[model samples]
Each structure stands twice: as C-alpha cells, then as structure tokens.
Target: MLPLSDASVLVRRGDVPSTVLDDDLVMLDPLTGQYFSLNPVAAALWARLERPVPVGTLIAGLLEAYDGDPAIIAGETRAALTRLVDLGLLLVQPEQAE
Candidate 1:
C-alpha cells in the first residue's frame, strides 16, 4: 500500500472514463478494459478528484460534509484512496516542493 502523507496529492488518470448512475459510479479503465464500481461516497470523492487534491484536504472536506466520527471518516478515506491507487485508477504525487 502506498503510504499517503497528508500532503500527498491524488489525481485521476486522464484516460479513464466514468459515469454515475443511480448513486453509483461506474469507471472503465481503457487500457485494461476493466470496470470498477464505486459507492456513493466514492462517487462524491471522484467528483472532487477532477483536479489534483491533497489527502488532508480530502479528509477535511469529508469531515465537514459528512456526519461521522472524525477518526473513522479519515481512516475510511485513506483506505479508499489506497484501493484506488492500487487499482491503477488514481495517481499519487508526492508533496511538491514549495
């Protein structure tokens, strides 16, 4: 699993295509011709991932928008991100020098 620091940036690969239907997100990986279905929370995350997003920012946004224990929300968010990365659906960029 990728060790995602708070500053790690996540970006969706440009070639992947996805659509939302009845609260679920269906994504196709063109290269592998594999399809992935994501739940409502992940669909929402996908929308926010249109642009590069920092992990910390993602967690904070989820906390503000959803009702859940902070720790659980953060843990789930991280796990979801790791799965997306492992599946080659998302890319993780190391913290940029500033």
Candidate 2:
C-alpha cells in the first residue's frame, strides 16, 4: 500500500462504477463483486477525486468547507484516503519529472 502524505496525489478509478443514493454514494467492484458505501462526507470527498489532487489540498478544502476541528478533519481525511487506496478505488499518482 502506498503511504499517504500531504503531497501524495490521488485520483479515483474511472472504471469503477458508482452511484449516489439519497445523501450517500455506493460503488461496485465488479471483479470481486464487492460493494462499498460512503457517507455524505466521504461522498463529498469522492466527488473531488474526479481529478488528481494533493492530500493537503483536500484537507485544506475540507477545513474551509466544514466547521470541524482542524486536527480531526485532517486526520479523518487522511484515514479516508488510506481506505480508498487500500480498496483500489483510488490511485496514487507517480511523481513526475521535476
């Protein structure tokens, strides 16, 4: 598993199928026939993964949009990203040539 960091860039897998129901989002992994559910907050985070974005940027955006504690928000965001990566629903972008 890739270690998530502030600079780690992440993007959702376009091939995976997903749908929003009510205030949550559900995704299906056809290979394993496993389905995953995301709460409103996680769903919001998923929406942002349409394009690659730095983990720090995601945390910053969440902090600005929510009234939660800074540390809690950052920690939860990182945890969520980690889970997504482990599930193969998200991808870590390889560093490009500088």
Candidate 3:
C-alpha cells in the first residue's frame, strides 16, 4: 500500500474496466469479478484519472470547485483515494519526472 501524500501521483489501474452512469461510476475487476461504485464526488475524481495526477492538485481543484471546510474536504478525499487504491481500482505511483 502506498502512503497518501500530496506528492504521490494517482492513476486508475489500466486493467480495470469501468462504466459511467449519470453521476455515478462503476469499476469492475474482471480477474477478481469484483465491482465497485463511486459516488458523484468520487466519480468526478475518477474522471480526472485519465492521466496521473498529484494528490495536492486533486485537493486544490476540489477546493476551488466546491464549497466546504478545507480540512474536511482533504480528509474525505484522502480517505476516498485510499479506498480506491485498496479496491484495486486505482494505483499510486511516484510523482512523474516532467
């Protein structure tokens, strides 16, 4: 498991298959035959994973788009990202060299 940090980059695991509904997203791990669904917020996050992104960038974007307590938003986003990682729907990698 990777530690959740502002510097770490997150990306969707390329092998997982995903579907998008009106405001929801579902991912299926064909190998494991496990399906996971994301709420609207998580769906938005998932949509952002078309390419790798830094954790801090994700939080900053959310903060700019939504009205909420910064700390609460950070904690919930972190937790959501962690769960996505654990579920094999997402992967964490070292920040890319650019």
Candidate 4:
C-alpha cells in the first residue's frame, strides 16, 4: 500500500464492535449502525488501525500475514482503504509536525 497521510485515517476504540469468527473480523459500527465482514486481508488492515499505523505498515503486515506479492496486496489495500475512507468509518487525523 502506498503511504497514506496520517490526516486520512480516523478510528476510535468505540467505533467498532468486533469479534473474530473463523479467523475473520466481523465489526459493527454503533454510530452508523452498520455491520461489516472483513476478509483476511481486510481484517489485517482493520487490526492495524487499532492504532495509528501508516498505510505502508498496514500493507507490510498484510504481506506477512498472507505471504503474497506486495504489488497485488498494495493495489487491493489501496482500494479497500479508499472505500473505508469514503464510508466515513475512519476519522482523518491531522499529520503531526516533524
């Protein structure tokens, strides 16, 4: 995954009600009352968002989890992240000054 600006992601502890089912992450957002099922790839991405992980880090973690080619994973992750961002599931945090 390409590096995403920190200002583009927002996730909170209470935003999702998540459970692991058959090694998959199923999450429900109470605020939006939306239920989501995450595939292994998506689950890995979601897990990383528990904290403010860089998009590149998230992609690397997924590569480790699935042992797949980085290019394919990166493309897929970018699309998924975009969708999540558009869905308002994430709150963008402003980039911290170096």
Q: What is the C-alpha RMSD of each candidate to the true structure, in Å?
A: 1.0, 1.2, 1.9, 3.4
Q: Which one is best on TM-score? A: 1
lDDT of 1 by residue, 59-94 (tens): 999999999899999999999999999988899877
Cα deviation at 42, candidate 4, in Å, is 1.1
What lDDT tens digits, residue by residue, belong to model 2 across residues 1-98? 75687888999998889999887798998778899999999999999999999899999999999997899999999999999999888999986656
Clashing pairs in 4: 10-91
Q: Which stretches of candidate 3 lie over 4 Å from their true place?
A: 96-98
* Regions of candidate 4 where Cα sits further than 4 Å from its true position: 1-13
Q: TM-score for all predictions?
A: 0.94, 0.93, 0.88, 0.73
Model 2 global lDDT (CA atoms, 0 to 1): 0.91
Off by over 4 Å in 1: none
Ranking by TM-score: 1, 2, 3, 4
What is the per-residue lDDT of model 3 for residues 1-98, given as tens digits with 9 covering 90 to 100? 75698988999888887888777788889879988888888888888887999999999999998899999999999999998888878888866677
TM-score-best of 3 and 4: 3
Clashes of each: 0, 0, 0, 1
Model 2 is weakest, by summed lDDT over 10 consecutive residues, at 89-98
- For model 4, residues 5-89, the per-residue Cα lDDT tens digits are 5244445344567898997888887877888788876876777787775666666677787767888877888788877776667
